[model samples]
Target: MTSASLLPSGLRAWAQRQVGPITAVRDVSRLRPGSRVWELSLDGGRPGVFLKAASGVVAYQRESFAYRHAVPALGPQAAPQLVESSARHLALLLTAIPGRPLAALDVPRAARYEAYRQAGVLLGWLHAAGDLRGEHRVEAGEALQCAARGVEKRLTAAGDRVRAAERRLVLRLAGDLLRLGPLPLGFLHGDAWERNLIWSGRTGWVDFSRARFGACVQDFVPMYCTAWAEDPGLRAAVLRGYGRELSSEEEYALMCLSALDAVGCLAWGVPNGDHALVERGRAVLARLEAQAV
Candidate 1:
């Protein structure tokens, strides 16, 4: 595909020419079938790598930043290598860890939970790094706001009444919620749903469109509630991975944040792309609202 077709016209050519000789176009259509990434089978057969275009969305940017920062401090802890990247377009190229998405597997519940435990270690280390704070938070917020604005525009264009209206409302709500109590700030995966985790011979995180310096709860919510029933024990383990014990109120707030996120996505009608997330958010919201009384 041409550059305008995916990223800047010169992007692929430029990236291919960098650090090594150009080898392949790999694929072109990110969402259609193969546009998301390209396989770089280098000349020496050292090992093939994947190149992520910067034209990706916010969560994508967050993934790039988080991985880039974390690789040095904790790549082995819970991150991947950055062979090459273009934070300019939120594109990244890395050692693509081999793994089928965990969600795609028919694994035993015990094994699935184990994967969750290991992922928690990665999340924990990230939370502890504390490098992504203050100014970092502001930048991440900007990216999120940018993405939200686009979602707003797209929903409006999609002409889905409930969706467009809901998106507007959720944007407003997220703004209001942001004002709630100091709002736990830490690095978050932003969109840590099931399919995002690759479960090859090992478990690996694949996407980061939602990576941001915001509520750790945002990451926790998607990590737990989105794909499975509320696993309190697992949640505890995640907190433990962070090297901190979460307060009851903190846990409750995590649920609240997740609820808000679901509603926000529902407003767009594209995220999660199904009703289950919205329904789960509503249920969690009901419980939390009652608990607050």
Candidate 2:
């Protein structure tokens, strides 16, 4: 248990106002030193709550919107209930859901496959809930073109962080995606990696800091680099549970997106001093290059 005094004054005061007395505070953030997550044990034996402070207003609003509008469609069993939020403080207090992240759990192959399958089902439900087209009014081709430009800009900014060959691969893929027809769009759980999927008796999703409206294939990029890369069977299981096969164009888009993400990892990781992330980027790029050969 962390001493309440150790918490930021503003966070502690705000949390106390929202939930009354706080008996204990546990730091549960995956990133340390500057983490903003805390597990709070309340008075009167109330259920514990998780406090997540956003890094910025945009992040707070995006996550709050997802919790309010999108996550509920997945049902109470699939995600944590949003208790309350503070726009001024840029924080959210949520009901604590049970389970450890699937990435941290060491289970048998069969059990792991089942978890991935369940994750696919949950993601499918999330995407089916609504389309952003009604609100944003952006056509698919226009949206994809805008996304491609963003990727190109990022790759250019990456400069020497990415090898010349890798940069060319990403650019070629981006061009390929642009040549394809417009793709289907949906609300995406932007960071749907193993770490965000919790597994107790079943798989549940958490973390929506990156959730937004976009091409649905964008959601698979993280998994493609992680679990899908490790096991082709797991990838098949996800597609099976998703209950739909991606179009050939969508498949090409996935490759492009995955390549973009790999370069992004290298670009962001070097400056952030995250060696593991840089290594993962290198590994994914190597694999993609091998496949291309």
Candidate 3:
């Protein structure tokens, strides 16, 4: 759909106000189903900007909040610049950051490892800011419970024996993580995979649709379960750049988080007929189960 068709009137007007007269507003591409991202051409002949019209009010608010509040604290160059935000229209206009996704790069294994290590350092800087610690946070217990329920729901779809064994392991891990007492809370990018890294001449993070406050380790789950699990050397580089090794309890909790992420991938993939996702989900689950044993 064209930007005009996808963007509501309120959002269109908001975009115009931010970028002066819009000579052209075209749908560049639908990056995702609900996110209507557009490239704009201004009559003033300046460089065009990008506008993201979120499909839901909650997503809009979160992205707006993340761009306006959370990401800015990271540094001026760490993320795309937010040109404007509109709560009523559920949209935001931003200066386009130049980069292909990190996942698309065809670098050597060592370069990939270094990129992940740098990503770890950037995340460390973000966590150090502590701006996301205030209201609108998901407490550690609540976040764990949510992940546990997601795991349980997905496990229920399997055979009786498989379900029973996985459930037992998941429950035990969940209990142990919860018993660790209140986890250190911090801002989570929520989805911190390499795909989200915009790797131009410099690295820039994007897509804060899932950004929120939660257990600091929760931020590591997606990368750990998928990318790092695939390459042990890459995982070590990330840990080295992170400047600390996980304690025993943290390692256990991380395993639990990985299991939760695996189940989520399973739940989404099974119904959608995504064979690769399904295979990955099963592989990660098997790894988690073996670790538990």
Task: Order the candidates by lDDT, highest first.
Answer: 2, 3, 1
Q: What is the lDDT of residue 235 in candidate 3?
A: 74
TM-score of each: 0.70, 0.92, 0.86
Model 3, 1-293: lDDT tens digits are 54345655676787887778888777755343565777888875698888887779878876787777778765656677788887777778888777778887987776677777877777766555546443545443377666655655666664342466776776677666666755666766777878787666566677787876677778888777778888878778877877777677667678887776666666767776767767877888799877754
- Residue 280's lDDT within candidate 1 is 58
User: Which of the two, 2 or 3, has more TM-score?
Assistant: 2
Pairwise lDDT winner, candidates 1 and 2: 2
Per TM-score, the best of the predicted structures is: 2
Clash pairs (backbone) in predicted model 3: none
Ranking by TM-score: 2, 3, 1
Candidate 2: tens digits of C-alpha lDDT, residues 28-69:
776633347888999999988999988788889889988998
Which whole-number lDDT from 0 to 100 does residue 134 have in model 1?
Answer: 70
- Model 3 gets an lDDT of 0.72
Which candidate, 2 or 3, has the higher lDDT? 2
Q: Which stretches in model 2 have alpha-carbon errors above 4 Å?
A: 1-5, 32-34, 131-133, 137-143
Q: lDDT of candidate 1 vs native? A: 0.58
Which window of ten consecutive residues has the lowest lDDT sum in model 3?
A: 132-141
